[model samples]
Target chain A: MKTRLMVLAISLASFSGVAMGFDFGKLLEDRLNQELNKDKKTQPATTPPPAGSQSAAASPPATKQKVDAGQLGFALFGDYSPEEENRIGKQISGNLLGAVPLVRDDGLQRYVNLVGNWVALQAGRKNTTWHFGVLDTEDINAFAAPGGYIFLTKGLYRRLNNEAELAGVLGHEIAHVTQRHHLKVLKKSSLIGALGQAASSKAQGSDQMVQNLIGNGAEIMARGLDKDAEFEADRVGIVFAARAGYDVWGLPTVLQDMAALPAKDNRTSLLYKTHPHPADRLAALGEAVDGRLDGIQGKELANRFYKIR
Target chain B: MKKFLIPVSAFLLCVSAASAWASPGTVLRNEQLFSQPTSGSRVEANVAKGASVNILSKQGGWLRVTAGRSTGWIRLLSVRAGAGGSGGSGVGDVFGAATTRSDPSRVVAVAGLRGLNDEDLKQAKFNAGELARLEAGTVTTSQAQSFAKQSGLASVNVPGLPEPRPAQPSSSWENN
Candidate 1:
């Protein structure tokens, strides 16, 4: 009976990985096997299973199940393939640029990308082809698109006191990508399903679905991620910055600065609508950083930051 | 002898209490510790990289830290806060657990038209050229490393922070 339960647990564990939206079945399988092996090693000798059960455990039933190619593709590639996500991101990015001009300074753009890329390398999805841009708008805003695109408005850029602050902002956006926040939102919005149906049917209306998906994704982006997601991004962002050797206070300090800005400021209107008030963000961040990060002093690099700008 | 021991223990208690100011910080770069938190004050000592100091307090950008027996001020930028700060497993689980909640079936079929208002997001048009430009600006890892080296930013291994507790209902933004 214990062996049966163990087999069941292993089968469910493997299936759960696929069901949880992980696209890499092989990776998941390997991880599950490792976990199982680790558990076996750590099990107490007094509760050791019968010798016959050892062989049965060694070859779990989960690995023997035949995974269909279609099922495998769906399970291994998530709802959208990486290429599909990249294409969608490009289209949305194009549309976004159409609405707001990018700051055309090549040097400044490169500098931002360099800093952003450095911070992004420390993220979980390090291999993602990250791109960073400065939007030409004066609105105090930043954005992240699926497939590793991050943007910071010039207004927000100019206000940052140091590289750590800039890193904090970029890290927040990168956190969005690593967490797939927008992508999950897109998947949940019905637009992807409509596109999938149109594509499968070879209908002429597929183009319309594409446009709708893009539009809806843009609207979601503009409207902003859920408050929970925003808070999660803040925590992840600070971690990334701290991992990359920037002051963890950068995010909290920026929050404080934003909080200090008058509520009526036009520049903050869009940002305010899309995010929790800065005071709330600050309080959340303060709690995270106060005791945890108070020991390690990180570099602000203010002079170098100003020089690049 | 009992009275003497009691006085010694009381003095030690006071010392321990005084030493526990705040979190400890590590020096990121070689910097001067000043007698006063301000730059104009006399130099107390020259602290090198990787020195551990207990942060006593902060005066603007200067941190009051005690490195060894010397208690002085160091520029906030000169030290990295926390010891061996690494983005711990605490955060990984919080982010990993975020599942999509929106139901696709509830989405409105009618697509809206676009304009400048925030509501115009429904009608946004794609600009391929701008995307191409954005993609073109990506920097390679080596380039990023060089950039970091140029800015004197060195990677430090700080332990990841624990998962933040859920926000309290008393937050001021709840009204918004």
Candidate 2:
């Protein structure tokens, strides 16, 4: 009797964290007792109710564990809907913001959004709603979520000599979103587990819909994409910036600045870990762009660049 | 004359501010050094793929460099501005300090700041309130277009570069 009471107490404690109704807690205790009774083997396995009205009142989803390719929009081939992609991005971006909030500068945030959205316009992904923010951290890096969510650290922002450079950085991240690089990576790494978790998670009342799809926190951002994906982003990003009427050399210049940094700079630790060496990127970019960009005319806009206060 | 001086002075300020002056750089491939920043200018000298050049100044996509006795402008892409000779093939990294923090300004910028690593991200919580704030700052495409118009940044007709054919030499990055 004491053990059963302890089990009931544990069930109620766990369920209470999600702020479910007390009726649901009682239902869970009944389910717990049913499981304990089945464990003794003397009694036939008694199944818990599919869901008590109290639990059903919480509006849980269907209890299906099967996931087809279409649901994930498997990116290159699978057509994951924009709505699904936006949820993943929101969860990831929200987690990242939790780690490091926005820089608290309205002007900086406004400037970044304007510039990011302008460059994104050239990307031609009309279906995606782009949101850009500058992270408060001084760590020099940038990130892009699956659905048009992008960020650059304040440290990286400070390194920009002009708006062109900022456009270049934003363009690179924008390429990642347009390319669906993260979605592809997520799809490839943990398909079985993620799909199952995603299906199971839907039945819960919490807002972690596809939380299992990406695992904990914003760690996916730190899991760098493949070399070719990165290189492709660099190539595509340069064109994106150029097409937006900014100097073609903007991304290259940013890479040069990063390449020239001393190897020990902790600020670049995440960057180097998550990217090809700036030297390698510059070389690869050179191979693609030997004389192609020669005739292109664009703006540097050095004077109008917003200085971070 | 004063107008020309303005550009030259601004150019010099950029080079100094970059602090890449006299920085050791490795030429990624053989490139011709031009007397001016543009390709149409006179060719001063040709530097080989593995040659080391001293980065003197930068303007747009060009880097004025002194390779051996030849001092001229080279396409910035043709050279990487650091001491990693030929980059990853491991040629001139004898002291191993080639990539050491050499720029004073960069050193200052990097000082006293803790890096954001994988752990901090993995342990982060969801900030729904901040997410709302981020969404609030988004600009519509029309708003962006008008903003671009304010700066005279019209869209242009630039073709995307062709993806390079594979078969790059073994790179250290692949190991990662």
Candidate 3:
């Protein structure tokens, strides 16, 4: 009996180490108990929930991971000279626009685009032109493709409260484009070579989409970006958003929402996969906005361009 | 009257020749050039190579050159003469010191294995030697990770950390 208990302890300890940021130990124990109860001898109907399981309500899994869309975008922007970054942006813009049927809620797209333009102008990328688009999908995702192309998912759009939030998100995305962080990451991963290889292929349509999704996602999350990159993006994003007349609090608030999300809180999912923790990001954003914009409050210019219920 | 005019013309020619001779070698040097004279400032504007400068005087290892529109002095050693016989002095400018920082590119082949975060697991390539090289200071940390990812080991566990047993073992391994 003592040896069995020891085995359980070691298993739990090992499970905890492997499951960092996840509550898999209790789940594992419950499964073990279930197996034991199925024996020919006397079997307990149900096992007690593990001790840590009680706090499950407080912290659900990783559905709420903070995704550094900026890093994702920057990973696409290689460390080309400012001139090269601009040229690549133009090429990517032409290629992606030709490929994807971008979301065109005229009002929303224009509003987001205007905000994006304003933020981009303030962020000051002298060489590249910035373009923003809305995707028709309901998934809660926003992507900044290489070469200054940004796509906002309808799911993310429907969840936003106002222009400030949109501007805040746009600012983050713009920062990614300006910083060319995606390309820096790609260079880190050596995917820039793969891009040259990809270029040689004649693949188009769904094939390109598959290549893009797989290539792009692998490029960004592969080997996991350093935590510093996400932190810097948030810092720069807040400033750009604030300069573009969006309330500085929008970023923090968005982060709060993300932290409160249920289902995606795995450590790897939260940090290496998506980005830094939303809580950490929120805290960083708060510190950045504080005292920086003294007496500067932004007003939202709402119109037919966008409406929030 | 002819003799008088001839003497006067000769005198004028002599004066002109002397002035021309004086201008060519009038190079300034060091403290003598910077000493309180024409312009009243401790420092002069940045001087470029092959710039034209008028030498006011040549002192011990220094030259008082007319820098830009204003005249100031610079070390004669610091100034180089223009390509021609023109008595021009060189100007020296100050720049901030450059510092050496680590490069991420060098560590592309030997990165150490750490457990993968979900993001890292997605990668299909990685190079361990590059990561090890980085840890060994042979490459940069960023480069090491990059190589590890490229070599398809992005999600492999970091070597330094305690590892769990593999889910399955071969019969020879199990015997041990």
Number of the top candidate by DockQ? 2
| Worst-scoring 10-residue span by lDDT in model 2 chain A | A58-67
Instruction: Give me the runs in candidate 3 sitting further than 4 Å from their true place.
Output: A1-79, A86-101, A195-201, A204-225, A264-272, A302-305, B1-176
> Per-residue alpha-carbon lDDT of model 3 for B89-175, expressed as tens digits?
111110000002112332221123122333332332332222222112212234423432332322211111112234355222112
> Candidate 1: where is the Cα deviation over 4 Å?
A1-79, A191-210, A306-309, B1-117, B166-176
Instruction: Please compute and give the TM-score of the first chain of candidate 2 against the native first chain.
Output: 0.74
**Which pairs clash inside model 2?**
A73-A79, A73-A80, A262-B101
DockQ of 3: 0.01
lDDT, residue B26, model 1: 60
Candidate achieving the largest lDDT:
2
Among these predicted structures, which one has the highest TM-score? 2
Q: Worst 10-residue stretch by lDDT in candidate 3 chain A?
A: A63-72
Poorly placed runs, candidate 2 (over 4 Å): A1-77, A192-206, B1-20, B88-111, B168-176
Candidates ranked, most accurate by DockQ first: 2, 1, 3
The digit string of per-residue lDDT tens for model 2 on A198-281 reads 222221122353555586678888888977889899999989999999998999999988777776678887888788878888
Residue B70's lDDT within candidate 3 is: 42
Quality class of the docking in candidate 1, CAPRI style: incorrect
lDDT tens string, model 3, A67-163?
1111112222223444435434433433333323345445555556656666666665664555677655444545564556665656567767766
Report RMSD (Å) for each prediction in the order shown.
17.1, 11.8, 27.6
True contacts kept of each: 0.40, 0.73, 0.02
Docking class of 3: incorrect
User: For candidate 1, lDDT tens digit of each residue in A1-309?
Assistant: 334333433343335344332333344445434533443432223222122222222222344232221212222223555655565566567667767768879988988999999999888574479889998777788888888888888878988989999999999999898888877665434322222221121222122333334444256567677776887898889889988889877876676566444444456657777787664564455455544565566788888784434
C-alpha lDDT score of every prediction, in listed order: 0.62, 0.75, 0.43
